[model samples]
Target: MPLTAAVLLRSAALSDQEFLDALYLSTRDDLQALAADPALRPMIAPMIAMQQKAQGLSYQASYPGAEYLVIEHAGAPVGRAVVHADADGLRLVDLSVLPQARGQGCAGSTLVQLQQRAAEGGCELHLTVRLANTGARRLYERLGFDVVSDDGLDARMRWRP
Candidate 1:
């Protein structure tokens, strides 16, 4: 079945907590799969937990200048993307989708939404991805993000609007 065009992009509300938690939990298996490197393996769970906490806290109160968008498909929350201004451009703080929502264009659609939001704010978009996450890298590249630098395990990518 085709996903509904009714997929909506909107500011996340407090009611989305459970959906957010589900999204965080869904990434565990994927994260583990990417943790093939001995050094990276030990860091996966901690990093995922930390990111989940950070994302959850981001909904507490609106920061001075940050925009967090939640993507919903067929009335159910499926993903989230957050952008904040930085010296170089609009930094992508988070971009995550539920496991079931992967490979369904949800992440790509969220990126398009983020790019539009960034453009409206007069900024380019930037994000850091693990070098080993080729699937994510490919998605980002498809959305016009170019690799700017690699700091060990992380690659910094930028998308100029």
Candidate 2:
């Protein structure tokens, strides 16, 4: 959101699980709405944990060598990014910033850094964003990523140096 947010990435550690879990929940507005219902509130915690685990497992299965990094601002963890670099290119398996840290340029700055890495290595940067996530798709387009293909649910985008 701002020019001086100082967002950076560091390897995520096992000890960061609590923070990571909270961050994951923060990104799920659907879950938040559901949890607001009295009947659903009781199911929120377990659901979050289950979904987080499933997501981790899916990413690991799909991107075997992905780097799991914590997105930091002024040395504080504000988000997480999972990236996989291969001979084809660098794929951003996942990226999410906490609600409090959104609109402060954390995610954008992180993507720029990833673009730099991709440029240095002469490879394309790749990612898939949910079709429902128009905000993120717009941001990626602003950073010069082009939509290469799309299914009904998600769109595959690419940025080449």
Candidate 3:
């Protein structure tokens, strides 16, 4: 049977560390693809390392001031999105869907959830995407995010509430 759209967007709890770690590691290929650029390689390497380390800790201990939402479908965690408040707005710090779940609207649905949370807090939404990640950029664009600044390797996108 095909997966349904009843995706549960729940705040990731401490026990979800293993699941988050698995999700993070599963994105290695995607990350390596982005790291192919020499300019982005240096910046992304350290950040990736930091993320890996953080994934080792309990979610509650590591993600303070951030809302980490796990997207569950068919009773399994398939994606994750993190949002935090910034002076500009509610910034999306990270968002990823498993390779197998990419085209199933998981990412878009997760974004809708994040946007709803931001709306409840009366804040706009913002995020940055690598210039080479056309798929992600397109998704953000489709969700009403506009390029606010071009930082060569990445573009800072914003959605005003």
lDDT of 1 by residue, 16-96 (tens): 777776677676777766677787877876778788787557644534467667888878788887767767777877788
| Per-model CA lDDT versus the true structure | 0.79, 0.93, 0.81
Score candidate 3 by TM-score against the native: 0.76
lDDT of 2 by residue, 1-161 (tens): 46565788999999999999999888888999998899999999999999998998998888997999999998899999999998889999999999888888899999999999999999999999999998899999999999999999999999999
On lDDT, the stronger of 2 and 3 is: 2
| Candidate 1 residue-wise lDDT at 95 | 83
Tell me, by TM-score, which candidate is best: 2
Model 2 scores a C-alpha lDDT of 0.93
lDDT of 3 at 134: 98
Query: Pairs clashing in candidate 2?
Result: 1-104, 1-105
